[model samples]
Target: MAQTATRHAKLWFAGQAENWALAAYEIDELHEGMEDAGKYHPTHKQIKQAIPELIAQYVDQPLTALEQAINAKNKAEFIANYDKLTAGCNACHQATEFGFNVVQRPSFNPFANQAF
Candidate 1:
């Protein structure tokens, strides 16, 4: 889950850099991550099963919008949906009693060796 969230943040960074191609690639990766999570991420499966409504509303829906914006290469809509995605993540955390682990649009690259 942390890894997926980190990748999501990186997607945001790529979008912020106006690197739409990179952002699109990362969006694909993020979607794949979610798919893998559904299959293999135990906690993800648990929460998703327990709170289908929240997951659908916050996580799935926002990610679908993000994907659409990325596919369209609409910078403005992409930015808007990125914010939605961030809120969705935090909303999930809060719903699951992990609100202290606040996810934000990262201010710096957490990857020390990678350039954004």
Candidate 2:
């Protein structure tokens, strides 16, 4: 989950930087990670059940919105919803009592060697 979240953030940052290709790749990865985590992780069912309906929507909604934005090549909408997606992630973390793991708009890529 943490890895996925970090990748999501990186991708969101990439989108903000207008690196659409990297953003698109990361978005796909984030979706896959979300599905995998919900289905096969040890805490799978528990995690799913614990997610409140609104939070669940937060998870689903932004994913769809981000995909649309990417498909349309809409940078402005992508950035806006990217922030929403980041907020949703942090909100879920806080709701799950992982507030200390707050995610933010990344200022720098941890993967410095990777060009996005």
Whole-model alpha-carbon lDDT for candidate 2: 0.75
Candidate 2 runs further than 4 Å off: 42-55
Candidate 2 residues 45-70, lDDT tens each?
33544343534655778888998898
lDDT (tens digit, per residue) of candidate 1 on 1-104: 77787788789888877788888888888877766655664354335444445556678888889888877878899889988888888987888777898887
Instruction: Compute each candidate's TM-score over C-alphas.
Output: 0.80, 0.80
By summed lDDT, the worst window of 10 consecutive residues in model 1 runs over 41-50
Worst 10 residues of 2 by lDDT: 42-51
